[model samples]
Target: MKSTTSALLNRIEFPVLLAGLLIAAGLWGFVELMELARAATPHAFDTEILLAFRHAGQPDNPIGPLWLQGAMRDITSLGSTSVLVLVTTATIIYLLLIRRPAAALLMFVAVAGGKVLSILLKFEVDRPRPELVSHLVNETSLSFPSGHAMLSAITYLTLGSLAARFLPDRTTRIFVLGLAVLTTVLVGISRVYLGVHWPSDVLAGWCAGFAWAMLCWLAARLLQRRKVLADSE
Candidate 1:
């Protein structure tokens, strides 16, 4: 039995196994957050996290210094639609220029599809933006799941995974992926700090975004293995 189990594990590619686990965990987490989002009473978890960003006595004042607030705004912009689109376009162009049209097309579809999915989710949930605290930036969209958080995860993770394929060193690939996750997490946190979204919204965004990105990665992997997509640059 032990040998059989070991052989079964060895038969699965490590990357595929990791991606499968992430997808399953993400889907489970998203469902849990959905329940929270639909509840009439706001969950205590959301309120506590939302208030943590504010100053002790002043709800209007964020916890960080003035410069920190400015820095956060800049960090948050990394997840904005304009910035992400520009990055995706530039990346696709670079990939094409390097004679990797297949990789470039994959990049385009992954990010673009993620955008459509985010929009669909926003309408499906029809949850309103948080009014518990003042919004630091202007926003007038349904907010059961944060668009910024989700898109940032999708964009950064997809880009990072693609970049990893071209890198030769194992450590370098891990670093690239870690940076992608870090950027995604920071963007999600910034949305809550800005008071534009509840904590649950960001959680749901992360869950959905991660699952979608992994699925895309897995699909691309399968295609490459089948000679339908480019194996490398």
Candidate 2:
């Protein structure tokens, strides 16, 4: 087991390690900020920001609980276990189509791991949903680290990174990455607009999600490199 671990670590490129470290640092700082905000004036700036976002794209005259309820349903639906399961199944099919079982397995691990971690964090923090504003959507969950935001980040980013590998040019790769980021960002924003999460909650979710995605990406790259080296030998 020790030898296996050693060989695996050896395959991780130095640059990947550096990038991971940087990402980890940023995420750690963000986590600290969230904790501070939660502890001291949890209803101050973060709450205000979230409320502003909630009203930004909302229907005029406030549609009462209907739209809000629907938005809540949509966000909650996005986090359903079935979505994760279906995504994993789709990824497997895609991997089979592309003949890359190893990468597919890596993606499955990333997404599954992200889902488990998201649940754990939700329980650990147990942050309450915002009660300050009329919810555009009704939801009942621990609000710290929005589940939809984090899951979307991990799943979409993982798939996006994998997709980038298949693109033939830098422009195409950038476009794919941009789309992934946009989707993730929009999902996070939607949580706030729907009044289901605090700004800090969404921010922490983004950090955690991005950190997990990057870590998994590094792992996948390391695995792929070792496989290539083994084939050469």
Candidate 3:
């Protein structure tokens, strides 16, 4: 029994353990945010943060300069459905062209699965978009978990991690992953800045998005170990 336990422990590497912890933390954070979303009144923090983006007396006027609002619109579009679809499709095509069909399929599944999950969570929470401030950009969907934030995280992080595998050096890999995270963070912040989503909504989106991305990564790792998915050459 002691030997068996030792062997099992030896198989659990630090990266795997860290991924497991991140998944747990993400899920717990998401659940707690969901409770807040379900409350009748928005959390004080959510209101205060959302209002902070706008002028003190005028909800219609955002805090930043005109150019900044335009820039935010561009950034937020990075997480838009059309843009994400384009990016995911292009990446999948590239992977297929390189003869990495397994990786391509996994990428498709990760993004598609995240999209469906986002829709389900939005409906489940049934939270309306914040009306405390004027929306800089129009959004019609139910807005508990920002679809833009969650999907951006899932897509960018998945692509980043996958691309990192094919990179030749550690620094390049880290840079790619860092850019992905940065883009995801910007997208989330843009949602808030545009006053289309509450702060909690973005937070929930990040939690769920990170968790789902990590879950997919862990699954891919397992499949590679089992020879079900070929490792990147």
In the order shown, the candidates' Cα RMSDs to the true structure are 1.7, 6.4, 1.4
Weakest 10 consecutive residues, lDDT, candidate 1?
224-233
Q: After superposition, which runs of candidate 3 have C-alpha atoms over 4 Å from their true positions?
A: 1-6
| Best-fitting candidate, scored by lDDT | 3
TM-scores, all candidates, are: 0.94, 0.78, 0.96
2 against 3, candidate with superior TM-score: 3
Candidate 3 lowest-lDDT run of ten: 224-233
Task: Answer with 2 or 3, whichever has the higher lDDT.
Answer: 3
lDDT of 1 by residue, 121-205 (tens): 8998888988888889899989978989999999999999989989999999999999999999999999999999999999999
Per-residue CA lDDT of model 2 for 81-171, tens digit only, reads 5776787789879886767777777788888899899889888877788766666555777887888888888888888888887889999
Of the candidates numbered 1 and 2, which has the greater lDDT value? 1
**Taking the tens digit of each residue's C-alpha lDDT, what string does model 3 give over 1-233?**
99999999898998898889989999999999999999999889999999888889999999978999999999999999999999999999999999898889889999999999999999898999999999999899999899999999999999999899899999999999999999999999999999999999999899999999999989988998998888454
User: What is the lDDT for 104 in model 3?
Assistant: 92
What is the Å distance of residue 230 in model 3 from its true position?
Answer: 1.7
By lDDT, the better pick of 1 and 3 is: 3
Q: Indicate the residue-level lDDT of 84 in model 1.
A: 98
C-alpha-based local distance difference test score of model 2? 0.75
